[model samples]
Target: MQTNHDHSDVTVRRDGHIAIVELARPPYNYFDETLIGHLVAVFEQLDDDASCRAIVLASQGKAFCAGADFSGGPTDPQMPRRLYRHAVRLFATRKPIVAAVHGPAIGGGAGLALVADFRVTCEAARFAVNFNRLGIHPGFGLSVTLPRLVGPQQAAMLLFTGKRIDGRKAVEIGLADVLAPDGEVLAHAVALAHDIAASAPLALMSTRATLRQGLADAVLAAVDHEASEQEWQVRTADFAEGVAATAARREAVFTGK
Candidate 1:
């Protein structure tokens, strides 16, 4: 069965061993500064609780997240620092995070999907790393994670071109672990969480740790890369192009500044 939870712009429901964090911003769930703190707060709450071993991030919207809330103007100066802090916490949480991608996961939203321990996506889901299109450098450990997933070559193509891949392709490319019907991604992620929850907790946590040791370095390295890139972009003319296009809801034409 389903349960309803009401938070400011997010809803969190916990039942037995699993918790679901729903991005309830309709039409688009692109995170704002407040919502980012909400994300960190919910995850922190889950981290402290022994009963909640699994989390599924889902959304009730046309998009899983379009990226950071570009509609608000410029990116937060403190966001990179905060993003890295939260990423470190997520890595060390030991609890498994599962993402149920219902629609477009673009830019930082791509980072959110893969930030989870496991990911499931809808057949209609679209994934893109459009930081280049946005005239911003990547954040959320993408410099390290993208190369690990699609290899540096394919990752370069996607990052530079800002092209989107469908869920079927995402699964085939090893980006999505499971593919479900458009509205059925939450069910699949929940099922996966239940399966993980049924297993021995200590054993699962140990395995999760073993797999994440390498990521620790990557996370730090990505923070550096994203910082340098964003610092440079803040001084560029092309960044203006990206911001204008995004605000106008049109295509960005970056001149490679």
Candidate 2:
């Protein structure tokens, strides 16, 4: 098959019924537009392949994903299209993809983790939708998925407050299904995928499909809310305060604008 990805930073290898895709941006696998498109295409192909029984999502880095590359100066004209392309993978894929998370999965990072069918986080992992801290709105259907995992009340608190918490807390809130030792996340996910591979493929497919029917549309609606809330937050005094505090390494005192 012809592949459409930058394998230098990401790699895919298949062994029997297990397929492993590793995000390889070292130090932090911060996603860019190119990377997002590549991943969407990869997941699309995996969903179509009959030989592939299960997938393990792992990363080679200190942080699974630190979110988007924020070092570049703000305001990219292609931000939405780029972001939505990434969102497409999270929403459209039909296969069972399990994420093995370590360190910080913040901003877009958390979205990537949430899209997986199952997630295994190490003791050191942290999850957050931190666009409020960045003075940007959340993207990637988090408005729906976060709430679905932890319920509306908790979701609102996480979003409005921009809270980030460790892996155990993530599992406590239903964001992670398994917790493992540091650096052992991938091996654990692969083991789980092996177990999933033992199940009847058709049955697994049907079960997942039946459960996911309205999920895409619902998440799209939540993405709209993320944009609205994010836009408003970006315009508030809180945004400036957050940004300044982040730069100065201090806690922000939000006025609830």
Would you list the clashing residue pairs of candidate 1? none
Model 2 lDDT, residue 8, Cα: 73
What is the per-residue lDDT of model 1 for residues 141-223, given as tens digits with 9 covering 90 to 100?
88887787778988898899889999999888888889898788999999999999998877887888898777866787777
Worst 10 residues of 1 by lDDT: 84-93
Q: Which candidate has the top score in lDDT?
A: 1
Off by over 4 Å in 1: 1-7, 76-78
The lDDT, on a scale of 0 to 1, for candidate 1 is 0.80
TM-score of each: 0.90, 0.87
Writing each residue's lDDT as its tens digit, candidate 2 over 75-173 gives 353564446646755677777888999788988888888888899997799888877676667777877788888899988888777788899988988
Candidate 1 residue 108 Cα shift, in angstroms, is 0.2
For model 2, the run of ten residues with the poorest summed lDDT? 72-81
Would you give me the overall lDDT of model 2? 0.78
